[model samples]
Target: MDATKRPLRIPPQFATYAQKHELFELYRRLIARLLMEKPEDPLTFMLEELKREDDDVPAIVIQGPPASGKTTIGKMVSAKLRTAHITPQILLEDDVSPLAAKGRAIIDKNQSIPMELWVQLIQARLKLFDCIKKGWVMEGFPENREQGLALQQVGISPKHFVILDAPDTVLIERQMGKRVDPQTGDVYHTTFDYPSNSEVEKRLVEPPEGCTEAEMTQRLVLYHRHIDGLRRCYHKFTKVINADQPKADVFSQVITALSSKHRSLAPHIPRIVLLGPTGCGKSVQAALLANKYDVISVSSGQLVKEAIANESKTGEAIKPYVNRDMPVPDNLVLKLIEDRLSQIDCVTRGWVLRGFPRTREQAENLDTAGYEPNRVFYLDVPNDSVYERLTLRMTDPVTGIIYHTLYNPPHSNQIKERCQRHPEDSDDAVQKRLAAYNAYVEELSDYYQTGLHINADQDPHTVFEFVESMLVSQLPTNLDRD
Candidate 1:
């Protein structure tokens, strides 16, 4: 067979291995980078990417407005990580590098360093063997969007870019109380954090002379101007830390953000689960998503009904309890769902599971089976609405389609005349089912920690539009959208 037309056959074990090691996500990131860059030497680029492993090298960026605790948090993080702390002052005062010579001349004239020169200086500094080996935490370079992009162009990327933010009022007050130790260059706020040692306290002085009120105001204006662009550039690995709290709290939050793993910039396989009360439009939303995404829609009720219709072995086992209007065993229901989800279509394209795994045990079972959903939605609707929607609805026997008399009436008289209300749609049956759902709803909610709760009390179209928007937001930030 020709190479282009050859069929791809991935070993079944590859799925288990990929899930364990996240190799699928890694490949997705590599492919996304290739498409974005379109480099000339594709083979060489792949080789370099395979060999490069600096992703966990502890490069960090701390940025904020004046007195928002960037320097304090940066120093704390560098000390905790045992990484080099690189500040702009350190770069400017350096006596060795050639760029420092040019930068010093600009500073002597009281002129700001140009963006290109600043980028070169930072690029050179980070490439030093000490920095490359021990990694580094950068404090106060790339103060604006242009500077940030310039550094990016020279391949200077930080794994974690933290933005410490506080209200202007709070920041201004902090600056008023700001104290500095000239010997150690440590910043402190008198009210929030003071020097405990008397020796340190006695020698503490006000900040250097040139940071006047006008200069501070100008700096704040410039920071606010480019804040949005900075967010856009590093949003994938960015975390905003609120700095209005105590210094210890601020430092703790920064550490937490830094220690967390960076999420993959890969499009995940759509393993979706929808949970809701009986009349919350779970099936309608699931169908809409399946149609739009070309993914399979799996429903336990539908699957059981099909099996009973075909009188298959699994269906035969479930028929007796279902015939008595009693609940089927959890294991039987789980097996049916497992068979459906393990098929080639669901495995490759993806699947949207509707109203299954209703209890905590079932949810645990699904996870143990390696079918844990990446996206879960619990649609919330008012009790009155659920009762109203369920009570007035009937199915058209000929078409097997459901409609409500007040909300979604049949257009033709013939279809309306033939509609029959299901026994399970009666008021008493719905009440019983609702009570059963209420009993375990909390358990299921607690089990799925990352599941989203959406207010689904609106029309079906509006609910679906909101759900689709959430999915679109999860796409890789670097992927181009038309």
Candidate 2:
């Protein structure tokens, strides 16, 4: 048996104790590192990894337009993580460095600091002893792609990057009611986060006249223009926080992102299984994960179709049942799945399996065949959502792409005209499938109780983010490795 698939033999209480202290998680991290490093001295390597885990520091970057709460959330996260909180002002005030002195000179002349000088100033601050040893959280820097890349070129990179976002209307309203304490530089909002202390309230003052509504609006316009490039640059490590929520919720998300350990990329052979009802986007999410992680995507239905097209022996055996719209025998289907997953590519690079093991028997058969999934996700979409998705979505014959009528219309008329609905997508057929799924889903759920259930009714991108976060969190962060 593959060591990963070996069954654990332990008492229930011992398992509970390990879970409480996250010992299983630590073991997963160590195994991932062992696979990637493949050192001869495995024990010493593991000990070094443990030591580095404790000593590793966090470098975080928080960015947003004015009044988007970057400063407040950045400070809160820094304090919680026990890292230094840094800002552009803090870096500029450190006139000991030549870059800071030059930046201050430009600021003193009432001119905008160029991207080159801004990058130098921030990079210098990040290279300081305290920032290197304890890590630092920086706010309101790298406003454009050029600056972000320049910092990267100079070997300055953040372990975690956050973009706090809100609607323009909400941001404008927040700025309108914004207040600051001149002595403490603490920001407050008149409507949202007013100062509770009477002394602080008495000392609150509005921002300068230059921080006007029109100016803030212009800044927002510029932010939207430059945001796409910045997002692309930091896409892998980035987390977007909805700043329109309450302050505590936003801070909670920030802290979670900062404190959570996530692999920069998968170094293990990921055996992922995505389970959901018909039209719950199991295939879609599986394809996305495959493409993102360079894993093979395996769909049982697609595999059967391809086999039939190729006229293989297994295809010939199963064609009759498929042609007559009959369910293939479980033994034959499991045989086909076992054969496919035993291929060299699936064994080496990894694979994302979709629309398989629909029953408890099939799940058991897979384990017996020595093809166990390391990660299983059950997309929890409602019946109504599945009905809407199937009934209203169209499939492109030429491209084999599926698009929803309301949520994902075709980009051009040419593609839209050729799109067709599957015959089996009728309401009656959907009801029957849903009923069948409901019958066996409980058994499958009971069998794979460790599987993560994802709420799939949200936007597809949001669902993907939630799933990806879980996947990345399995391995240790790559900060120390780098």
Candidate 3:
């Protein structure tokens, strides 16, 4: 009988997996992947990646010595991570190595897996794991410099490295004090998580027969020997936490550390740019994405159109040029955009900007205005799709809220009376806009450091989700408060 198999009811969500195993894998993968190396220019690489349309995910590394409450911390932290928690034990379960058969036998007999084979196995398995979307968190896999360096060679950056530490005495005592249920193999710690049953609870406080002080001491010694070198390997991003304190306290620090680090640029307002061709849902997506991800939005086209609708002096100023679909002068566009950006909505609230930088000169002037976006999203809708979307455009003449008959149709009976057709809604006008877009799209796309290409031909929700998920990847900190 498996002693570790507790008859105690595990949540059905965890019925297929052991709770401990799930937590270990959660953090092991996170920490391993945090060291995911990148090329010389990651953003430039990302630009090329956008052209090819690849998947890129953020990775976190939770590193610590054994019995330092790292696994417990990993378990607690996994609940908050947006990505997968990957552990070393997952490697043993999904082995394809030539020596996997022998490795299985050795592990079953309780022998340590050899180092050379250990590295190979971990590297191989990680190759298949996906960190291209929601990134991953890792725990308890890399204990030495070899494993750490091997991970970097595999192209992962150690963006966040957290080390859980405790006094040698406390770690040994904690390990030695644990009571293992021989029948169920469940481990109970008197100081932390303990079972509810009286007998099980009693066993935790009083170490059972197999629990010994010696093994704990031996394990601690072995861990300390290699921990220094391991820590040095990832010193750049390492954050140390004292695990001798209460688990909750230690975990709180873990949360703060991970949150502020590579989790997303914390405390830095997300500056995002959504530059795409006309009618590619750039305006629609910018508005949706800004609302969904908690950012403000401004569009050059929207601003000019709004000015025209308001019949402002600037509106009449640009009306002649707009009537002919001719490009508005940069000075006129920049002034309107600058004034709009200074308004209450865009000042404090981070903005998703579009439309101002219509040319090389405008892009340079945008820099002069002290606006630089960290993330750029390119809506790569097919030309035909762009034309189709533009042709269907409708707008509420009163409120200036945009709608599409198929995509964002207005519900009110007044739509027929109140709505206005976009001047470019005609087939020839749509074609002309697309042609103009193609003429300058490459230069504009190349102006930024990196941009993510999105397939906007899909449903609105899918497009928004992809853009939102990408923002979450780059700047995941939720700005949900004052």
Candidate 4:
């Protein structure tokens, strides 16, 4: 993590005995050029480095004054975004009103915690997490300029900073309105959420002297002093939301801002939709394209199945139809697919969607969700080819690697021996899937005005060559690689 101590570049040397003069000169020039290269910005370098290492995880930071809704907003954003949420309070001492207020005197008077102590807390807390890998949404750390610099020093630059802004009056009202259940850590607000009975509520507690107007004014002063400088530091990635608005409106603004910022990180990544029949090698091509292009491959069916397995709300709603061998309603399916595709992984890494948009309605929904693909690939293989490939197909369940008994086989028998065969690889199941795809394939294709139609009956290499070449020609040169 040290920004200093860049690796030493050993100078090139030539042996006296029988050295090729041209090669020696080339080596000397290369070494000199290496020495002349300017040093890199370590923070920028580390940002790229971690994205490559943890493509699926997105690290986020939410910053605001004490009562600007950082905690509530952080929690909601984390759930909607499906990323880890960490509050620095937990990084402080175990049990207190605000965990960050350890030596309570300074903080109790609406003053800043020591810069060194705050930085140390962040460092220790981060060490316990694989934040680089799974990503994180952090709240209430980096309370001021120095702490933000400390974060930079540690090579942790967030993808986005959500900065909530509100008037002093609004923040004061929020602070006064909110109450906490220390036993369960459940927070309630006077207007948004309240106890059933004021007197009968055994759980309620009176506000401390800190709830008074004078104390609130001091807290506001402490809060504003810190945020203005922090905002200046993170202006490029900061989205200022008005916390004075209604709760739902504020939340909606936060979601839109965060989502837009995340997408902005990856400008034009050749977002693609692979549409074809079940046995037309859609999954195979999706995987091949993802690997060659260094992007993500998502299977819509698998996403739906996963939702079902997790018993999500969407899954619960779609359970009856899916069980009855009918397609899950477009609304539920589209929501699930939209959530998956909008994740940080897809935004930054790029993505190829499979088994999605089987019908015109679903395709329209995908467009509504802002998934207008750079190109829609329709693999046009004959019915005979489809059946032939399906009958011979076997999958390694552990790896989800598709193999055709006649066309493609495991190179080593040892691997072939251990592969878990999927139960649905049976011919009956394959026919059912193929029949379902055939019924609606025409309508799906008609949904798009233009598309790349490949004769998938050809060998895999030839088809992939055409598809990749078309993508290369269409996408900017900046794309075609991560």
Best by lDDT: 1
lDDT values of the candidates?
0.83, 0.82, 0.69, 0.71
Segments in model 1 whose C-alpha atoms lie over 4 Å from true places: 1-45, 129-134, 235-237, 259-263, 271-295, 299-349, 352-482
RMSD of each: 8.5, 13.3, 20.5, 23.0
TM-score of 3: 0.44
- Candidate ranking under TM-score, highest first, comes to 1, 2, 3, 4
- What is the total number of backbone clashes in candidate 4? 0
- TM-score for each predicted model, relative to the true structure: 0.59, 0.50, 0.44, 0.43
Candidate 2 clash pair list: none
Per-residue lDDT tens digits for candidate 2, residues 329-351, read 88878777777777667766778
Candidate 2 local lDDT, residue 87: 88
Q: Model 4: what TM-score?
A: 0.43
Please provide, for model 4 over 10-31, each residue's C-alpha lDDT reduced to its tens digit, 9 standing for 90 to 100: 2112121113233444444344
| Residue 319 CA displacement from its true place in model 2, Å | 36
Model 3 per-residue lDDT tens digits across residues 411-442 = 87788568888776888887876787788878
Residue 39, model 3: lDDT of 57
Cα deviation of 70, candidate 3, in Å = 10
